[model samples]
Target: MEHKIKNKVEEPFSFKKRLESFRYAFKGFVWLFRFEHNSRIHLFSLIAVTIAGFFFQISKEEWALLFIVCGFVFAAEAFNSSIEFLADEVSLEKRDKIGKSKDLAATGVLIAAFTALIIGLIIFVPKIISLLN
Candidate 1:
């Protein structure tokens, strides 16, 4: 006797389905840390700041700034990844305009990352100085 296999297709999602989607979305955060280079860097930076904040007694305002900067940098990196994926999907063959647009998107992320680095340095330098004092 031979057995036959059946293939089933899932239906389109409804509002409840969409809300349920968030469960998987939250899992993306874990996958992001595992797969994304920038996410790993951001996680490392967050851990470092958290340790410093505890040990050096960072002020509330400074912690706020650190959180904001770290969030901005990570968001920019995510945006850059989205742009690259979209651009690649839209133009599988490399066109000059698409290349330029992707480069511009990357530059925006680079600017955000650099700005965050400067902010981090400004916030941490004083803490380090005080520790030495």
Candidate 2:
């Protein structure tokens, strides 16, 4: 069986429409932050990582890499959340396919977070060790 999506907003873009798009995006961001526990956790982690970057006095190259990896993790989280929302909309009832889809989306966020953590540890661990010594 095929599922049908109802709304299609594919109108040609004007400056006003573009501005409205940004407003919609900001709205979504606030909604996500308000409702999603994981988004809040990610935001807190981002704050700590930024502070650590300053304290560690990482090189410019290291700072760039840290920023990139962090961005990737955040983007993955956003995507995962979107997928979860769509999946729930598709089927509110308990279905095996819906459960697996949600799980797979969650796995994307988990993998991205783990990858960022490893990169962060690699960059900071040596700096921390040297400071200890």
Candidate 3:
């Protein structure tokens, strides 16, 4: 017996759909801060970095680099959180494979955070040494 598959029609693009997508993304951004502990940590780091940038009077180019790395870290954290939530939904039981998946996702966030830290030190350490001298 052959099975007939029904083809789904694609919907035409609309401005309304684009607006809805932005709304959904904004909601997810709020949810990340509300439910994700590490996001809050990132927020604190962001604020601190902003303050330091101002105190040091970083050049426009340095500001751009800082913004890029900070954004990268947040993006990594968001991706890691989504993977964790999906893995949990798949199975609440302690499965080895699921645990490994979560670990791998977390490693992305770790790498991003570490890179940001290095950038911060590079930008600030020389200024600090000069200030002390």
Candidate 4:
């Protein structure tokens, strides 16, 4: 026999609900930084880069690029963490496919971080070498 499932009532959109969504997103952001070790490492790198940018007095364009890349790295890290959490929730078994999924998620973070590093070096290296002169 086929079973039918009842759908819950859909609530109407309101300004209050919109604000609550932002609150939930902020909570998740805090939780990610608090609970994830890799997130902390990224946070450290972000801080270091921001200090270097100020010390070097990076151009406005450079500041924009730095902000974009840093945001990308953080977003990638958050996505990877989410995938890991969801995978664990779905199954605790040592499955090959699950392992592969986690690895792929991590690879995304790695690529984002590496790209950010290259951009940072391109922007900062010349400034540093010139200061040495």
What TM-score do all the candidates reach, one by one? 0.76, 0.86, 0.90, 0.89
| lDDT of each residue in 32-103, candidate 2, tens digit only | 788888888988988988899899887899889888888888788778888888988898999999899889
**Native-structure RMSD, model 2:** 3.6
By lDDT, highest first, what's the ranking? 4, 3, 2, 1
lDDT tens digits, residues 88-116, model 4? 99899999999999999999999999999
- Each prediction's whole-model lDDT (CA): 0.79, 0.85, 0.91, 0.91
* Count: clashes, candidate 1: 0
Q: What lDDT, from 0 to 1, does candidate 4 have?
A: 0.91
Candidate 2 regions exceeding 4 Å error are 1-11
User: Which of 1 and 3 is the better model by lDDT?
Assistant: 3
- List, residue by residue over 1-133, the lDDT tens digit for candidate 1: 1232222133554798777788877666666666678778878978987897888787899889888888887777777777877898998897998899889988987888788789888988987887789
Check candidate 4 and list the clashing pairs: none
* Candidate scoring better on TM-score of 1 and 2: 2
What RMSD does each model have against the real structure? 8.0, 3.6, 3.4, 3.2
